[model samples]
Target: MRTTKLPTIELSLVTLRSIQKKDFKDFFEFGKDKETTEFLTWGPFKTLKDAKTMLKYIYFKRQQRNEPIGYAIVSKETSKMIGTIEYHTFNHKGNSCEIGYVLHKDYWKKGIMTEALQKVTQIGFEVLDLDKLVIKHLRENIGSKKVILKNGYKLVAIYEKQHFHTKTGQYHDVFVYEHWKK
Candidate 1:
């Protein structure tokens, strides 16, 4: 495997880096939008400063892992961060990882995530040598489930009432999907 610098694994999106501190404001704005945050595990940011604090935490994790923690899905035309996709729970020896993604509601249905996941999954398999990738989505989130299926991930499991509604404080069923590169 070619273990190169961050730039080597960075996805192309017009003119932006994979993830940057300067992108915090845009990330905050997108994440705070109700439509965008509805399916996310995190928040409706009360403030940008809160978002910055979260960004700091994200950077800390990246430093510790010495890996590309995540990528800010960006737009080439406007050079803005539109969303993000990441792998967090990695089992190195198993060659497996859990994936997560979210985009600004405005960017949904544009196939932005499909393209980004294709590139990222290629990297996870070809470059990182991961054999399997798993993605999960709330069962009610039809759009997210579609994204996973469209990306070639296969339905593997369904967690009964396993998703915690970030807004409603209710538990819901979630569908777990997996893809292997073999």
Candidate 2:
């Protein structure tokens, strides 16, 4: 099930809004970076076709129907799409979901994800009324670790070879975490 009102989180640095068709080029800008997608399970998007397919199937279709599945993190200063974040996996029966996100390489180490995550966490608890929120990160990704932990997500497990990274062509251990609504 989807929320009746698609979330629109406002923050000092960025505004999390529904991804738009006008953001196509900006989306491609970050999605196509091999370095940016290094630890991610998906994307170093090769072609505009790949970008369009992903944007349409994953974001646009739902957005057009008025229930956006995710958000585009638009920078306030430049007003450009810098990243995407959302509860990618939903479990209404359990009242929990998995959060996922990606940011432009240039924006890394700027505390952007942490700020965005704080807002998303608020939405999961306050807006969605979810009982808990789950998140995962590649063990090697210290950046993800920091963001997850900074938002009060607790480490639950380290599953061995849990993810097959397409870019690396190898399996890597994954760390699972959860944030109980409090």
Candidate 3:
């Protein structure tokens, strides 16, 4: 049975913690940024209500299932939610999971995501004992490609016309990366 629980991971520049209702304001701050959600499956949250609804779904519903271990990425200095990351699409029988993340555009290229991802990948392998972890991004998202590579993930596959961009309303190729426990 799956027994791993998402824990509050503290790092030098960021902390990955469970989402809170009180984070509504900060959540909306970045969730509404077009540039930040450009490559993400979900947002560009149109209203505060939308953000609240999403938080509820993320914190309550997803948690109850013990899947999609979600985290709110907070800046240590500002104590504000700057992004989110998660280990989702779990397959217990296969001991595998997919990693997903998004950061505020302002924090891009700062190595913040690299640090957060390294911590979460360690958690997936050492704590959860997962055998394989996968990460995928649009073929055009170079930033995501860098982050995946920096974490020692290898390009395992590419699916053509596999991902649909909500905003652009166009299908794009996706690159899948994976890391196996050594």
Candidate 4:
């Protein structure tokens, strides 16, 4: 049976657990913060319904397909959802997956993301049996790059002018990252 318990990832100031429907409110606040989502694929949520729908879809996907694992970062002391993370893009035949994460601005610079990434990467290689893992960050998202690097992912390539960014309405570069099982 699929586990109902959310995996725990501890950091200096917070913990990470599977994202839940109840976290929609906290997620809405974080996702709607322009500065917090400036480098994300989709964010700066326009409405509460938008955030709720997105979180619901993610939770449903986790329950149904067991892929695209999504988690909420929570403050350890307060037990409040503060952010999110995902391990997605499974390639069955290729024996690989990709990862991504986001943290609330209030929790930035506290090494929370780096700790979360380490745990997620361990799950990818150990539980998921992935042979390789990949990650990408918007070229200018320095915080994301730092977390990935701290978790042992190596810079691979730059997909220059790759995505037509919706927020900026222009092409942007993405830094490719990769990690291999030893």
Strongest candidate by TM-score: 3
Q: Which candidate is the best by lDDT?
A: 3
**Considering TM-score, where higher is better, how would the candidates rank from best to worst?**
3, 2, 4, 1
Candidate 4 structure quality by residue, lDDT tens digits, 66-90: 5645778898877888888777776
Q: Is candidate 2 or 3 superior in lDDT? A: 3
Candidate 3, residues 1-182, lDDT tens digits: the string is 24557779989889999777888899899999989998888889999998899888765576687664478899999999999888888887889989999999999988999999999898888877899999999998999999999999999899999988878889999999999988
> Which residue pairs clash within candidate 4?
none
Off by over 4 Å in 1: 1-16
User: What is the lDDT of every predicted structure here?
Assistant: 0.76, 0.84, 0.87, 0.80
Q: Which whole-number lDDT from 0 to 100 does residue 8 have in model 3?
A: 91
Clashing pairs for predicted structure model 2, backbone only: none
Candidate 1 TM-score over all chains jointly:
0.89
Going through the candidates in the order shown, the clash numbers are 0, 0, 0, 0
Sort all candidates by lDDT, best to worst. Answer: 3, 2, 4, 1
> What are the per-residue Cα lDDT tens digits for candidate 2 across 1-182?
34636567788788999777778788888989988888777688888777778888976665554443688999999999999997766676787888889999998998889999998888888887789899998888999999999989999999999898876788999999999998
**CA RMSD of each candidate after superposition:** 2.4, 2.1, 1.5, 2.2
Selected candidate, larger lDDT, 2 vs 4: 2
C-alpha lDDT of residue 13 in model 3: 87
* TM-scores vs. true structure, each candidate: 0.89, 0.91, 0.93, 0.91
